[model samples]
Target chain A: MDMKINIAGVELDNPIIAASGTYGFGHEYNEFYDISEIGAISVKGLTKSPRAGNPPPRITETIGGILNSVGLQNPGVDAFIKEEIPFLRKHRCKIIANMAGNTFEDYCEMAEKLSAADVDMLEMNISCPNVKAGGAAFGTNPDTVLAITKAVRTYAKKPLIVKLSPNVADITETAKAAEAGGADALSLINTLTGMAIDINTRRPILANVVGGLSGPCVKPVALRMVYQVHQAVKLPIIGMGGISNGDDAVEFLLAGSTAISVGTANFTDPYACLKIRDGIKTYMEKHQIKTVRELTGGLIVESK
Target chain B: MSYQDYSCQICSQQEIAPNIIACCLENAHLAKNAKPGQFLHIQCGDPASMPLRRPISICDVNGDELTIIYEVKGRGTKALREQTGKVQVLGPLGNGFLVDNSLYKRPAVIGGGIGTYPLYLLTKQLTNASVYLGFRNQSVVTLEQEFCQVAEKVTITTDDGSYGVSGFAITQLEEDHKKEVFDIVYACGPKPMLRAVQAFAEKTGVPCQLSLEERMGCGIGACLTCNCETHEEGSAHYKHVCKNGPVFWSQEVVL
Candidate 1:
């Protein structure tokens, strides 16, 4: 019934970590329950300068999921260190600073700055589709992924996790590029690029026109990609994309993810992570699994 | 600061107006903590199809029963209408309307269409308040008797001259303002109506609080989906409609 997971030397109490953007700075969900019960909290995506984000009608619902083009709206890294870090420091769970940038320099600068600050890990967000530049741009190209990951790796003092884009030709190519660039670990798949249009006005629902899709609808796709990337690379993967329940978390672990991150589920239920953790424990007890590590890459495939 | 998820039992459901249904839920905790402008994020139907929760404003609260009036506008509300037995709700969310009877005696409350539902609670809390409600026509007009019982004066208007005063409600509010100035103006409605109220509040130099709406995700500060532009000077040019406010000073927001 042990739920502990160690990612690149950083130990998590459980495998259920709150994903970036969906959980914000861990302030809102804390009102529902104590945030310390979860494994880790990945704060909202931050940048070198403050981003105003996209215009209104930023989100719309699709079948079993949602499309959002928030465009990395944050108060910049300096403000997060001064205003948010102190609050997160008081908590018992580990903190992962999710950082995005418009250029390699922006990535390196933030890496150097946040590495000196009070955060447990640094997650490079190179797959945000909402931003116009340097987000999905760097993640889709293997050479750019290697270059930026290597550049940020030089400055990041803590374990660096490169979050990959699902909107790519081959996810394993980029996963291999991140591995070659010295990433401590990998996390995927950052939302797929999609769009929704209103029929009456024949206008796009989101002001940005295109957005990233997340929720239960994308679970199957995310699982397939995680399985592919796991076979291609050696780095431990933090699989995320439409994980709602404990069974979903187990699917990710069996697909070869070292840990799992809950995103859209938090919106559906405030106590999603805690419920998912309990669900995992219940599954473990029923199956008589000794440790969570045994569940990783434990898929039973038919032998040829 | 305190909020929890409650599995509320559906005590009764009534169709107050065309396509508008009023449902009373039994939850003592939510009823006691709910304020005037706060809202509840409710999960409708099954989670497989309708994954997101709909944010419904508090219409009325009596003892341990909380009432929410919502129109069947989209798939979410359609799913909500079919709900029976019980529903999961997370509520009394966001900063509610600031009510200080000592500070403002004569208050003017204005609302249009479905927006008038949330104001019922506010009107009940105020002592010397005049209420103005507007709708498309007679078939959509609701809560007339409810407001009449609470407000010192009630003015109902319809755009097509189907019932009550024939014209926009703001026109009557402007005419009423000339005779006796109000200390404060509170409003919630369609954008056009809210825009007129905002201009009116600004021109008269009277303090105003407006309840705004947007397509929301988390119904909390966590998801930055529900955001509105503000006139405040800072790096953050926008405030979340779910957190910073579903209610804000008329002058503070851009509308």
Candidate 2:
């Protein structure tokens, strides 16, 4: 079965892409398997300047997911181009530079810089809820999402994907706003804002107190948001939120995501993307599906 | 070095202490490749309840058998204790301890509580190594015999005078350092113990390697969750404990 799919104009070998923050520069996972086997890698969130991120105890486990307030720790965009881009260029898969900023200027500067670099696509990470500034603040509001997307769109030479925050009322509003702002495509939902507490210490587990939750637990919420956003916007969706296995990927496609990104699953299994790719193929064969694209929005909801 | 997810089977398991269990697995590749300070990212429980893998340090390796000693702390480890037969494991991950006996002779190996488990493998690989171990009390003291078999001398301390030397292990290490200066120091323990060891190593001007533990997400460099602060040329930067090291030089990290 054909597994290739396209996000915006960029073609992928398969529908599975490694989500940002989860897969750092694609160097670490390369040790487990050839990273080129996956369609694309959304490198860790990049900022204009190097961010040291939050203090220790930045991560904690919840019921079936994890809470992280990493606060976008990265080596800055310049370093990424000089140090990491070369390593990623050697690999065959497409590179999606996931850039985050505390301001619209930060996003535009990074977009202009990265678009001139070797990356295949630029993902505006306005949805990161861990930071104190411009991350989710710009993502949660429709006007701000449109404004940032429009600002970054002007500078980004490559296809731009606006990652959406899940901690908002009516995610479709932001989805429509991104489309309005000239986003080539949309990806959602970025981690849900949540917190965990220690009863004994009577303190929040994460040093940042609040963090974004991702894993199998958030799959349902992500799928619902993806389905809703797909209905609300004309742009293709890259569905993500706790997708672990093949069936989960299939669910997202049926929910109207053109392609899917694997996030927290990479933690549980290093070879998760490869396994998920194989799982998608297996699912396609079992169902006599020809192309993986046929599965997108294939859900047959009976009219009751 | 490349790492693979191996389907390993439990060879044998036994409870060495209250809430502490030592289990052995059959994985020839891991046993042969695993070095001191390297860890295994194990899928302990069902993903629905415990989604992330539990990172456990390598305790010992004998032929095709790899051993790990873990304390039942939370839901994940509790699920690990109940696991039987086949288990999926990704290892031997992160940079292992660099063993250069010619560079440094008379190594001082110090460990505290559950932190002492990973040091067992290091102690076994070293020559003329004096070990210092600290535990809560007698009931939790484990691998004492294991360390004794490998080390040139072993000193164990308990906080409440319930076992061996009644005091902190760092005190014993300091007291012993005066008599015969150790060429190199290696330590793994709780934060306070590690901090104290870091200070001692700095004050003595002896080269030291410390094995650290953090709440990790991916037991690889991919997830920036497990990070430790380090200073280089006066600038502090974050290093992933899973990648840059579970082990680092004494002067490398901030704490």
Candidate 3:
């Protein structure tokens, strides 16, 4: 039997979801394949005001992944709800609204406005680098993470998933901070910061100088973080980093992740999610596994 | 957007001298529909190295195949060279040169270095025309026979004086203006070359249309990343080099 994970009272049909910032508004990829196949779609990160993003050289290819510093570029929340929302509402999958706030009021303003809007869940992008404070202060510390989660929880009647940043002292500590502060669930491993240099020109490949790295190279770190965090907190965790195929998704599930998000691979192959979803089923059948839930937390650690 | 892998035969895989190479796409459907100035995004390598696809333009299309020219600058192009026999392309993408099919009496097609690419297609579409091409040296010149086939006059130029007209292509265009009333000028080349064309056109009072290039994301209207400010104002705002343009009236661009 397929296990259903409930966050705040809303039930998700399955744990697999397309992470925000990867699946842009959920319409373009739909043209190539069916959108209803995925359990949920997290629209691109939305903020209170529209952002132009960093100037030229937004993405650069790395050893095992690509480093990107898009700077959370998107239309304002109001415009997203007005323009991109209607097309998404017609789809069968659940819509996870990824919201980012620069300050406390930005968080409250987004939650207050989105609480009345149509969305299955409101994902707080707490891990984003703060322009004023520098770095992701909200996600790095236990105190601010708790405060931001509680503030959004006050007005946000919808399910809230605190998207955590991996650039932290302790993954479990931040997860617990979110759980204690009233987070319905959590998502882990936003891009790891990286930089690349161009030899011929003797300048950085990315104009901003540094970028967030995501791809197969970060999979182990993401998995280890997911496995450790899952053991610490009871909140349903959505794991993501470099989940390319179904086997990778299974490792994430076995590591105690309730769901998995496939990014970067979608850029190379647009039909990534569907392929991973099918790969999961084939792996389960081949291994004689009955249900996906049984595979969750199934990592058997033998004493070395 | 179904991607079918294509293998390049010997003739299509010319060294074009040494470091420079040109690959051909042997797909019947793509070749039939591909317009000059249109480009194809070729997947160079798997993840771990060169993850993104590199965009290369269609140099020429014959029968059931299209060709692309490029110099191996980095790992992606090096990987593209390895795919020598098995190159996979995603287009005929982005709007190619808008053929002046509306009919013109006397037109001049100007090209500079590799910018001579789309002009080959535009000249084919311009029934009665003249071709003026400029390059640093004779070694870099391309499409001499094709331009000769399409136009009555092929005014070739080299800065080193090793070729036909020993000067700039734009200079030749200015000199020829005294010879005849060239109805319109169609061109594509380096930024400085186009800037010179813009200046020359301004001086001679000749109406010219140009093709602009920019690093593109979606090649559609959605991203709004690849836009060139146009003379047009208000809500429609700027012209997208991928969609609304790639082709524009020379004076219409803010440049």
- DockQ numbers for every candidate? 0.71, 0.64, 0.30
User: Residue B85 deviation, candidate 3, in Å?
Assistant: 5.1
* RMSD to true structure for each model, in Å: 1.0, 1.5, 3.7
Among these predictions, the greatest TM-score belongs to 1
Relative to the unseen true structure, what is the C-alpha lDDT of residue A141 in candidate 2, on a scale of 0 to 100? 96
Tens digit per residue, CA lDDT, model 2, A141-221:
999998989889999999999999999889999999999999999999899989999999999989889999999999999
What does the lDDT come to for candidate 1? 0.92
Instruction: Give residue B166's error in model 2 in angstroms.
Output: 1.1
- Give the TM-scores of the predictions, in the order they appear: 0.99, 0.97, 0.86
Off by over 4 Å in 3: A1-16, A129-135, B1-12, B84-87, B103-111, B129-132, B158-187, B194-255
Better of 2 and 3 by lDDT: 2
* lDDT value, residue A47 of candidate 3: 82
Model 2 chain A weakest 10-residue run by lDDT = A128-137
Residues B1-255, candidate 3, lDDT per residue (tens digit)? Answer: 333323334246566745678776687777887787777667676544555566677777789867777777677878777764555455666766555646557788888877787677667767878889998888877778878998878999998998777878888888887898787887888888888888877877888888777655444333343556665444233556766667777887766
List residue ranges in candidate 2 displaced over 4 A: B233-236
Query: Candidate 1 residues A1-304, lDDT tens each?
Result: 6888999899998898999999999988888888888889999999998888887888988989999998888999999989999999888889999999999999999999999999999999999999964378899999999999999999999999999999998999999999999999999999998999999999999989999899999999999999999999999999998888889999999999999999999989988999988888888999999899899999888999
Clashing pairs in 3: none
Ranking by TM-score: 1, 2, 3
C-alpha lDDT of all candidate models, in order: 0.92, 0.90, 0.75
Please give the C-alpha DockQ score of model 2: 0.64
CAPRI class assigned to model 1: medium
